[model samples]
Target: MANFIKIIFFLIIVGGIGIYFLSQSPKIFQGSPQEKVSAPSQTFVSPAPTSYTSPSLSPAPQAISDYLIPSGFSRGQLSPYFEKINISASYAYSHFNPSEIKLSSNLSDNEKVNITGWQIKTNNGEIIIPQAINVYEPSGLFPQQDIVLSGNNYVNIYLSVNPINKNFRLNNCIGYLQNDYVFSPSLPQNCPTPSRSEISYLSGQCQSYILSLWGCKVPDKDSDSFYVSIGGSSEEEVECRAFLDTIDQNGCFRKHRFDSDFLSNEWRLWIREHILDSQHDRVLLFDKQGLLVDEYTY
Candidate 1:
């Protein structure tokens, strides 16, 4: 019975020692308790991709940089003569002082256009183009004729009153009147020189005097010294004096009126008062029917 009791006591002691060693030793099933606890402390998460989109913009306005179009009209709605006959855009402003405006014709197909009743409407007011002599005659009654435009012709419109009491076409002889009257945009002084045939008829002293005189220039009739220098007592001197008298503008026109180039390329029209603004202005051209021809702005 004692041996059996001793055997039971030894078995109980061995089981207690095994239980104590297992509780005290480090764990090895998967990992240590500390390692298992620290694994979840740090975390990693990948970022998601993004999509792109484009922006929207508005369209720009349409405009013309050089000239202005009236509110009710489009460029295509204007007359067939729209750009064929046009206002002079060379000035910054079609100003009042020195007060001149110009109209030019640029017909491509060799057309003849009469601009007598055409209107130039400015910011100030409007003016009708009047008639003028086509070929001016110095001796006859002045007759106003329709101002016509042929190949490459231009008209100079003056804002002041007519100086000669009439408008007339300029000829080679027009320069003679310039001596007594002031013409705005002065008349050209391109009178024809004495013909070779005429010069051959004059005496040697008269020839020298004639050659010394300038074209479109009258001799100094008032200078007694000049008359005496030409030897007024002599026959040659008398003839030379007579010839000098004929060197005036009227004489020039009479001699060369039949020449092809006697007429000038420009026509001058006087409007009888100040017409355009000095600083800012808008000029519109209209046909006789009041249709828009062209426009200018400053």
Candidate 2:
């Protein structure tokens, strides 16, 4: 009985030690099958950090071109004189000076092309090329002619109000209008100088005064010094005044209207306001049939 009791005590001590070790181990747990699921591994998955983005505040780019070039129309080919016409790369596209676009014709072209009804398109707007008088007559009524582009000719299109009510061809006499109206690109003041034959009938003093006068200029009758410089009797002064009157545009037109070289190679066309962009622009030229003639970008 003593030996069996001692063996029983030894067995109880070994079982107590095993129970203490099991209690110290957290991973080794005594529980139901459902609880033994290892607590789903308790991995900290800090919900994928929410990402954010900001919106852009800038404006989108502006689209300049709207029309497609016709298939047959290519540079220097496939149309009547379209190839000979060109838009100058240089521009007066500013707010300070009058906005201007220049179109030129090749010097080698054999035939003249009428550009009336042609269209010039820009980023801001479009304009129809209008008819202008081929030769300007300072008459009460003026007729309109097609805007013709002869060989080595050019046109200056101004985006400003027309000084004259209608567009007209530049002439030697047109420079006289510079006194009354302002031309953006000033008119060519190349009027024919008066010869001695014009004043040979007058007295020496009167003849010298008349010959000394500039072409395309109206003597300043308003100035007191004008009469002093003329140094003539009232009757003679009347004759001088009459002669001076003939030096104006109307007078010049009357004198040189029949001359073959009277007309200039340039045309000045005025358009409505706000037709061009001041910062940058793409200019396009289309013929009467809306075929592309030329394009210029700046």
Best-fitting candidate, scored by TM-score? 1
In model 1, what is the error at residue 32, expressed in angstroms?
99
As a whole number from 0 to 100, the lDDT of residue 43 in candidate 1 is 72
Error of 2 at 246 (Å): 1.8
Candidate 1 deviant stretches above 4 angstroms? 1-72, 75-77, 89-97, 228-233
Candidates in order: C-alpha RMSD to true structure: 20.3, 19.9
- Clash-forming residue pairs, model 1: none
How well is each residue in 69-106 modelled by candidate 2, as lDDT tens digits?
Answer: 43434433323434467775344554336778889887
User: Tens-digit lDDT track for model 1 on 207-280?
Assistant: 76777766567777777466557755677777777787888877887899899999987888877655577777
User: Which stretches of model 2 miss by more than 4 angstroms?
Assistant: 1-78, 89-96, 107-109, 228-238
Q: What is the lDDT of residue 16 in candidate 2?
A: 100
